[model samples]
Target: MAYRCPTCSPDIMQARETIILVPGLLCDDAVWEHQNAVLSRHYDVIVPQLTRQDSITAMAEYILEVAPERFSIAGHSMGARVALEVWRHAPARVARLALLDTGVHSASADELPKRQALLDISAGKGMTALADVWLPPMVAAGRLKIDIALRERLYAMVERMTPEIHRQQIAALLGRPDARPLLAQISCPVLIGVGSLDQWSPPEQHGVMAADIKHAHYDVFDDSGHMAPMEAPEAVTSALLKWMRDDRGLCK
Candidate 1:
């Protein structure tokens, strides 16, 4: 379903083009709360729920099935990977692409066991305990201490998800396709962003992706972590605005 998040911005104008925002693992519409509020003013923005699928290919297919004939698409974390899959399947249908705080590599050697550790936590102590252990490291070191609201929102989102949903997403990610080969062949405008202090998917990882994709705009949100859309909303939004703009200056 399309998520038009509640916004203080004036009632949206008639939008001309569609923009799909894909949330990361264990995330919901709240993750794109800020961008949805602002971007909806100009485009037909929708945040697709990735909760049902057990594989990246399935998630991508879901988005493509629901999306417009042609649309600008952006994804955060695992969502970014899904966006890549979408592009991989139907590049001609994507008007523009944006990838934030994500990676293109397949599962690393140590990834499965590390992810299993969190799975074990959720299975045993429950989602709340898993959130306490897993969420902190995902953000910048001091972020949670200072941004109590961000911390709470993220925890609440994770807690709302059941262990089975988490397992399905993990399964999806573990079996994700290696997208590096597709990077050099992308013909559409691309935006790649990451947080300066993003420990999970560091800036260097994105820098390499930028190097691979021709003319991809690479941005780094300083003082932000893995959650760039939430942690650095303004900068991320601005970059997306520019990336989505065409010669006529609209998302289409």
Candidate 2:
């Protein structure tokens, strides 16, 4: 059986704008796979490869160069950092913004040790073992017991990301900026969400970002963690549909 979002259909794509989706650390299409199918039904969707640069700022510039003159951005985790950079560099180009399971702060010096350790582990033992240690924390702890397919999909995605790509993205995350200062400057409609159990980027952190954006819509998926798009796809997709259809979402 094929799944199509109730409000989304392939016929709706004509003359629509583009929406670029950016994935986080060790994430690729699998991160946006669900949202892409539903949302792309209405908009021209493009999921860019985020591995070409080691800095969020550079990555944003690269995306802007290739993206349509005006487009929305949906970025998760580290990709959210890059989206902020995009809005900072070219505010006029982004029609709407969605930041999922991400934060507005810089990594603490203490976080460096853990980031480096993940890199070292992946380099030494390979991505499968790294996925063994990692894939669990990405979802609500309860998900491991109930969702075998989600767990396997995440592990497979991580295993496909090369060690060098993982290291590049990790380094980019470790040295990323505190985006709080720029949050107030976002003039476009903003959508922010996080899993209630997201330790990597807690809901409270997204609340802070939403506080600064005058028109931000926020949500917390109780059944999810860092990977809300996968753990709670139906909920996330519905929220994204509302965001895309609302008149306020297209306002500058």
Candidate 3:
């Protein structure tokens, strides 16, 4: 069943296409807050809570379960990986795809111990300390230091998540498939983006993704970090709007 915003008029809802906004690890709908609010005006937008699923495939399945028969899907960080998995399972169902601040490769050799270190923090010090340690690196250094409201918002979002959730998501990421091969196979329009200062999943990574995907468009959110949706909402949302707008010729 298609989930229309409760506040939308029947005609408006019927005229719009559905779009799923997937949040990253330790992230909730708030990560896509600006996009969801703006896009809902012109499209039927659903921001699913990926907190329950432990694996990327499971998360993709959950999205497919609640999603409409056909829709555009956008995901950030770990959520972007889930989006690719969604297309992997149901290409015909995904009208378009946007991957923001994420990667398509499997986990690195040293990724586990590093991830475990954070999990250790979560287990020992609680989510706040985990947020303190984890969230700073996720944002641009300048923003983390200067954007008081942004830092607090990100911290609050992370603190809302449990250590178990963090553990599960890390496991999902570690076990994630090598998605590079899936790129050339993607038939729908694809948008690959990253923040210019994104240290974790840098713009260079997305550039490579753009090259592999046949119909991919690449973008970099200037002066932003890994959290582009939060740090550069306007640029991210604008790219999504253009990607979904058929008249803009992005699909061709």
lDDT (C-alpha) at residue 59 in model 1: 99
What TM-score would you give candidate 3 relative to the actual structure? 0.92
- Native-structure RMSD, model 1: 5.9
TM-score versus the correct structure, for each prediction: 0.91, 0.91, 0.92
Residue 212, model 3: Cα distance from true site in angstroms: 0.5
lDDT-wise, the better of 2 and 3 is: 3
Candidate 2, which segments miss by more than 4 Å at Cα? 1-14, 249-252
Residue pairs in collision within model 2 = none
CA lDDT scores, all candidates in order:
0.89, 0.84, 0.89
Q: 1-252, model 1: which lDDT tens digit per residue? A: 232222323454433778999999999999899999988888889899988999999999999999988788999999999999999998878878899999999998999999999999998889999999988878889889999999999999999998999999999999998999999998688999999999999999899999999888899998999999999999988988888664221222
Query: Candidate 2, after superposition: displacement of residue 48 in Å?
Result: 1.0
* Model 3: residues with Cα > 4 Å off, grouped in runs: 1-15, 247-252
Candidate 1 displacement at residue 167 in angstroms: 0.2
- Candidate 3 lDDT by residue in tens digits, 1-252: 334434456554434688999999999999999999889888899999987778999999999999988789999999999999999998888878999999999999999999999999999999999987888889898677899999889988998999989989998999999999999988777889999999999988899999998868899999899999999999999999898774222123
Tell me how far candidate 2 lies from the true structure as C-alpha RMSD in angstroms: 4.9
Per-residue C-alpha lDDT of model 2 across residues 94-198, encoded as one tens digit per residue:
878899999888889799988888888899999998888777888888677688888788888898898899888887888798899998887777889898899
**Candidate order, lDDT descending:** 1, 3, 2
Q: Which has the better lDDT: candidate 1, or candidate 2?
A: 1
